[model samples]
Target: MDGFYAAYLTGRAGSGLLLFAIRGPTFIGVDGGGVKYDGQIEVVDVGLKCTIVYMIPAGTPNLITGASPPATDQRIPLEFILPKDFWNGQVVGITTPLGPVNARFQKLRDW
Candidate 1:
């Protein structure tokens, strides 16, 4: 599939979110289970007052659905973090295949 997707982030630490855009082809499991996606996504972080591309490696599992992949892009809130530290900002961008998408972060309130 070729299109645009909006990705974002929320929470922090073990509760962090990795709202990704599912891309590529979809297929059923050998056991005729839920669908699965065979594509990758570009995880962009806007929590550092800047845009950073977080590499999800090449063969990261459980990126799609728990059992079957959705027909369209799904916003999955997975546990995400920046190394040993936590995400200090909000906002995230999601683009698949290729990107240079526009994204921004703003301070809502002081914590």
Candidate 2:
């Protein structure tokens, strides 16, 4: 199956974009500005949370997760990429530094 899906991380305190390509492991998901052209994202726990690691300026690796060595405020910008095999529908609650945000994952049968 040629999997294709999209997600948006809105309600950001400032302007930012969360974009994922239909194909490939590269994305620049922070709206209205200069973001890195390449990065990798891995979603875990059936979309419950994701550990986003990106290396910008060539050496610095930035990571975002619910809890870890890279703990971060939920208010910070984040993104997700579901695998093609993911089929469960769920509504995820993300607590940001601003407030609570909900993201829904519904399977789209068509393009």
Where's the lowest-lDDT run of ten residues in candidate 1? 26-35
The residue-by-residue lDDT of candidate 1 on 1-111, one tens digit each, is 222222232221111222223223221111112212232333346321212333333343343222232345443322222221122243344343322222222222222
Question: Considering every candidate listed, which one attains the maximal lDDT?
Answer: 2
**Candidate 2: clashing pairs of residues:** 16-31, 17-29, 17-30, 17-31, 74-96, 75-96, 75-97
Which number leads on TM-score?
2
**Full-model lDDT for every candidate:** 0.27, 0.37
Could you tell me the TM-score of candidate 2? 0.34
**Model 1 score (lDDT):** 0.27
User: In angstroms, how far off is 40's CA in candidate 1?
Assistant: 22
Q: How close to the true structure is residue 73 of candidate 1, measured as C-alpha lDDT?
A: 44
Per-residue accuracy of model 2 over 19-95 as CA lDDT, tens digit each: 33423333333323323334444445663233343322322222222222223322334445444454344544556
